[model samples]
Target: MSVQAQGREIRILALGDSLVAGYGLARGEGFVAQLEAALRARGIPARVLDGGVSGDTTAGGLARLDWALAETPDAAIVALGGNDGLRAIDPAATYANLDAILTRLAARNIPVLLAGMLAPPNLGAEYGAAFRDAYERLARAHDVVFYPFFLDGVAAEPALNQPDGIHPNARGVAVMVERILPAVERLIEKARS
Candidate 1:
């Protein structure tokens, strides 16, 4: 899709797992749609494509990198690894997958906004630390825009999530899109630059 329309539009790909997919919500309630609406409300024309897949791990995202990029995103929000953490996968492996994804995107001259994910507490402190560290290290190494945690204010709030507790509700998706908007504008700027 075209990145611009009326010289103000941007095409952003929301690439990740369930959170991006809006697991239990209706079509328009997903993160991608909500983010697009939010941007438009803010007078920033944008198209946030649905690149989310429920239950997808970072490895899965890495595998689909080329296809995701085929849409020619002006910028991308990388939100994978949540499923990896939930599955208690090796943090190093997750890191490698994310690193590869970022590397590939960079090679294609695409700007990226890396949204971070925390490992489930039940996985123990060591795993949690490694998981958290991976995002930071990758963001620094790749020099991409970073949002520390994608689920920030809505993670444990039952009122903000669906019955599943993991995936967000419609309202929760709005909150996420709100919180991430500024960073996304910065990402848009990066793409333009």
Candidate 2:
């Protein structure tokens, strides 16, 4: 699964919180596993490492940055900040944490596909605005590929999510994989280049 394998196989790190971890889903039904299977079905062989930790905030991600980077992923899907938003953490702190994470990835020359999340409306408009803006700002600054909202089609869809109404179910993971496949493919190409 190492990136050193070159063109033979691309190893992508799926880093973030519960959604990336496929919380409450069965072993093979998780996002990383589904994404890998989808990539293979598309004739792209890849190893998607599960770097997701439930309830992980951008700060938590920053703390574990070294360990994640140790895997030497060819590229990464940075999906943190959900928990931060959930906890109503200061958006500036969230931005700083994500900024540091992106900087470290860039330093390692690992291309990234950042999966953004919007702040819940319950967090208040000002806080929501700041949180929502952070991802795009960071993506532009870092020149990384970005997916504006991770839960696009799945959000608010009860059938696609677990009872808790946050984490996606297996079917929802499929939809996500389908929607993000193109970006992931582009990420793989970027890594290859």
Local distance difference test scores for all models: 0.91, 0.90
lDDT per residue for candidate 1 within 132-185, as digits (tens), equals 999999999999999999999999999999988888899999899889988998
Which window of 10 residues has the lowest lDDT sum in candidate 1?
1-10
TM of each candidate vs. truth: 0.95, 0.95
lDDT string for model 2 (1-193, tens) is: 3233345788899998999888999999989999999888777779999999999999999999889878889899999988998999998999899999999999999999999999888888999899989998999999998999998899889999999999999999989888988888878888887
Q: Which stretches of candidate 1 lie over 4 Å from their true place?
A: 1-6
Residue 139 of model 2, lDDT score: 92
